[model samples]
Structures are given as C-alpha cells and as structure tokens.
Target: MLRNIVLLLLLCLIYSLEASDSDKCVTVNVNNLNDLVLKTFRPKPCMTVNINGSGKMEILSSDKFKTPLSNTPLAQVRITGGTFSIDPNFFKQYRHSLDVVTLENNNIPKLGYHVFQDLILRQLELRSNNILFLSNPFYNCSIYNLDLKHNKIDHLSDITFSYTRLFHVNLANNSISIIEPHSFPDTVITIQLSHNLLSSIGQNIFSNLFNLVLLCLAHNRLEYINFEKSDLGKLEDLDLSFNSINNLNQAGFSSLRNLKRLNLRNNHIKSISATNLQTSKLKILDISFNFFINFPHASLPESLNVIYVFGNPWNCKCLFDIEDSFSGNVVSNTMDCKLSQIVNAPICISYGGLCVDDRNNTLINAFSKEVSLYSNDCRDLLQNVIFDYEH
Candidate 1:
C-alpha cells in the first residue's frame, strides 16, 4: 500500500528514540537488598542512587527501603562511604518522593526521632558523620538546606527545628556547646556556628531568629555577647570572628538593627561600649586582631564603609582620634606602624612598621596612602602624641 506506509513511520521513530533515552537518569550499583530490587525493573524509574562506596552495606531496617523505593521515582540519594545504621523509618518508603539526601562519610552516631519524617526535602547533606546527638531529626520535612558540617554535634535541644521549613543551617565543624532555647527554625535564613565549642550564648539564644540573615559565630569559645535581649531583628551578617571577646556590652549589639557586616576579627576586644553603638546598617567593620587602645570613634554608625583598625595597640593619640573620627570614611593602609610606641616620646621612629611624626619626623607610611582626616598631611599629627606597645 505504499511500501506498507513507509514501514510504519520508521517503526515509530525507533520507539520515540528509545523513550527519550529511558527517561534520563538511572544509575545503579546498589550491591545488597537484591541490588535495590533490580533497580525497579529498569524500564525507567530510578532518578539517582549511588549508594557510594557500597562495601559492607549496612542499611539496617526500614525493610530495606520498603521494597526498593516502592514505585521508584527517587530523585537523588548518595549515602556515601557506608556503614549505615539509619533505622527510624529509613525514609519511610520514600515519603513525598525524595529530592536530595547525601548522608556523607558515614558512621552516623545518632539521629533517631522522626529521622526525616514525611519528606519533601530539598537538600540534607550530613557531612562527615559521627554525629553526637541531636534529637528531633527533622519531622514532616520541607527542608531547604541543612548541612550539619563535620559532625560530632554537642547540643541544641528544644524543639530543634520544630515543624520544619528550614532555609539554611550549616553547623560548621561542630562540637557545639549548647543552645536550647527554641532551637532555631523560624524559617531560618542562614546559621553557621563556625568551628565550635561555644563558650557563651544565652539571651534567649536568638529568640526565634526572625528571618536572620547570616549569623556565623566564627571559631568559637566566645567570651560574651548579649544582643540586647534577642530577636535578631533581621540580622545581616554578624560573624564574631575568632573568639574570646573581651568586652562589648552596652547592650552588646542592641538587637542587631539590620546589622551589615560586623566581624570583630581576632578577639579579646579591649572595649566598645558606646551603648552598643547601635548599627544603623553598618558597612564592614572588622576590628582586626583586638585589644584596642581606643575605638569609639563617635559611637560608630554613620554607615561606615570599611574600617579594620589594624591589629590593635593603636594609641598614637588613639591614631589621632581614629583620624579625627572617620573624617570622611574610606581609609586603608592597615596600620602596624611597628605597633607604634611613644606615649610621650621615648624616641620613636618606625618606618616599615610605620609611625614617625614627632612633628614632621616624617616616615608615616600608614600602610601607604588613602588618608583623609580632613585632607591628609596625614591628619596634621600631634594631638598630644601617643603610642605604646613595644613589648
């Protein structure tokens, strides 16, 4: 009839190109449990499952993932370096069809209560395990990112992420000291808790992180921080860098006031009590290598645009009153002026280490340029000249 209608349209275009390459993703090497139920009969189902480094596959219980991902439609599950012991309803028959679950370098030490109940996950990478205990392991999930970095988690009880909808919670390095008060989950918006072994942090712990925006308590052992009675007020980046914070109470951070990048670098901060210098959206203020000799600079906040105050001990008249209190902002050379020392002229010169102005004794390369305490001359030095820390 026309060569049998062109051979039935070339066999229906080779069965629609083999059903679009069998619906795209279907890798497999599941080792045990009958090779994960023969990959759901391989006509198109599996959507990612690398049961990584499979040897000694110990996925004890949950009926070996209920008949192999019952009605397979999985969308990502790595289970790295196995020795797995994930029971508590091991993904309860792929509830709500998974959407990303890494389970890294396994040896999971703890995690029971509702181990990710009724899932709708969108990322749950349990990094380098040995997790020490964190009760409520996500229930009725709607998770949108929860890493749990380098585990060994110490403590963080109270309703730990109650009724989930998490936005991002890294928990860096871990060995967490403690944090019970409403454990976090006010639709979290970034929470790192860097390094860890937190020395202090209670003032209603973060009162319900009202949409917090980045709060990484860097390298911990924190000496103190009492954010004016909690409720992070939409915090915006507040990394208490390398801690041991010496002093900063004036209401610590006066409820953050939409803070904008305030890292308090290398701590033991000598002082900073201008009633907590309430941040009016501060813009970059590092307070490098602390132990300041003076730094209130008119209680800060004029929307500063970069202020590091190089490694402390500054007292060349408190760096000429922080160059007449941020004359017009932007200044960089990052002082060191040989750690400046001459409180009352004990013969100071310092060049490579800066500071040398005993009334034009010159050598003031305060890093080298970018000065303006009312148009430079290096801010007309000699404000009762001072500087001492040569020890």
Candidate 2:
C-alpha cells in the first residue's frame, strides 16, 4: 500500500510538470517569404504573456516584463479567441502579409502611426473595436478587403490610404465629418461611406481611385459635390440620396461618363439644368421628395428606364406641356402637381417658364398690367410727362 501510494504521487508530480512546460511560450514563423515583405519576421515586442497559478494568461506591457526566446520563428502562432494587443513596432519592423488576422470583439484602445503600414494582408477585420483615430491607418498595405467599420473614427485626414490597394472598404456608421482631398489614394473598387456627416466633397477627392466601381455615399449631410473634369472613367453606380443637396451645378457632374445608375432621392433640389448629360449610360434617375420647379430639358437617352420625380411641387403650367410632348421611355406619374388649375393652362400664351403654381388670377393680372404699361416707350413717356409738368 505504501509503494502504490508513492507511485500515485510520482504520477501527479509528472503531470504537473508537463502542464507547466506546456504553459510556456509558443513561437510562430513563416519561412521563405519575400525579403521585401513587411511582416517577414517576428515582431520584436510582439507580445509577452505570463501564465498564472490559476491557469490564466496575462499579457504584460513592454515596460513591465520580458519574454523568453529560443531563436524561434513566429509564423505558426495562432491567437484566436483571446485578448492580444498588437505591438507598436510590429508594422514598423516587418512588412509582410499577416494573413487571416481576426480580432473580433476586441478592445484595442490605442493604435500608432502606420500600424498596418506596408503590409500585404489577405483579410483584416477589426470590427467592434473602440479605436477612435487611425493616423495613416494603412500607410502602405496591399489588402484585399479591410473592414474597420463600427469604429469611433470621426475625422479623416489626407493620405489616410497612402499606399493601400483596398478592394472593399466599409466606413459606414461613423462620425466622419471632414474628408480632405486625396483621403483615399490608389485603387479602391468598392467604398461604402454611408450614414455619416460628410457635408461636402472637394474636387479630385475620388480622382486617384481609378478602379472604383461602386461608390456609396448615401445618408450623409452633403450639400455640394463638385468633381473635376476628369473621366471618372470606370464608375458604374453612385448613391447620393438621403442628403441635403440643394444645388447640383454642371461642374459637379461633368465627368461621369460611365455612370449607370444615380440615386438623388430625398434631396432639396429646386431645379436641374444638366449640360452634357448624354455622356453617361444613366438608366435610373430618382428625384423624389423635393422641390422641382424645373428639370433638365436635355433629352435623356433611351437607356433611361425608370424616373421617380414624385412628391415634388412640380409647376404644372410650364412643365405639363413639355412633359406631355416628351418621348422619354420612362415617366413617373407620381409627380403631384402643386398647382392643379395652372397645369391645365395653355403654354404658348405664357412665355416665361414657371412650373405650375396656384391659379391666383388677381396676381397674374396685376403682373401682366404692369408689363403692358411699361412696354417699350416707358422712358420716353416718362420724360414727356416731366416736360409737361415743367411747362
């Protein structure tokens, strides 16, 4: 019985020793990667985790503790479902692909300059983090898609995407108010900037994004959008709805040659006089829920299949005859006339084009009488009347 008890004690001791050994450091390294890659080697100050008596791993800051090492490479470390803060020097030293970096529901409060700079990453999803400012976030990253949405970023500075090739970026639902020019450099295909406080877009803001196809800026506070005269050459779909666009000048939309669909619903547009509009393949134009005293008379192409000009106070007297004569392929009868009686009036008798207004015959008669009395020789007649008074 004594020998059996001693054997049991030895086994327990051995198990405890094994467990302690297993709780030590684990290094990961990827071999034979490109020399110029950003994350080619293990990041010094990457992380140092200490195991406690209760089997809990505690991460120590660089100033607090040091980690043991055996010349180990760090391409094999898997840190999923755990809390780990990225070292500030991680991207500064190594510049290679950090493939499959998944940090779901992590609280990385602070990030340094060029934190992910010059790295070639396959996927990086830093969703649900409390990261407020990412200065030069992707200084030089070649990422496929970067989703930093749901972060608390407010201001976006210039060269934010210094040298990144981002395919799909979701910056929706943030407090981003100002977007200085050249904020997004290089090629970005799909960009989602919805649900923000972007009031204006300066010229050449989207000029460097040569490969952009889908640009979503809906649900913003944009009042003016002025694009320069360069062909947005590959743009397909653009969403500017749910905004405060009061006046859309010709300069604001000169170079959208390949644009297919445009959503301008729920805006404050009182008129639209488009010049050189036949340059685009616009199939859908939605101008609903606003004021439209005059819409562009430029004959829209036959490719236009849907036009939602409803819920606007359309002047019936001026536009009724024109809309009736128009041969456009699509028309939305939902455009309610503000002035019903004036809409049915003849267009030839009234020369000034006023979208239909209320049938205030008294005001109309007063205006016509003033015009007739002042017709042609009013200045001469005034002089004669003064001369008679002098005599």
Instruction: Compare the candidates by lDDT and give the number of the best one.
Output: 1
TM-score, one value per model: 0.33, 0.62
lDDT of 1 by residue, 60-158 (tens): 565654564556666666655556567777676666667887778777787778888778777888888788886787876888888998989888876
Q: How many clashes (backbone N, Cα, C below 3 Å) per candidate?
A: 3, 22
- Candidate 2 residues 269-311, lDDT tens each? 7766566356458777776555664566445655777666544
- In candidate 1, list every pair of residues with a backbone clash: 337-353, 338-353, 342-387
Q: What's the residue-level lDDT of 390 in candidate 1?
A: 14
Off by over 4 Å in 2: 1-85, 89-97, 316-328, 333-391
Q: What RMSD does model 2 have? A: 18.9
Candidate 1 local lDDT, residue 38: 50
What is the number of residue pairs that collide in model 1?
3
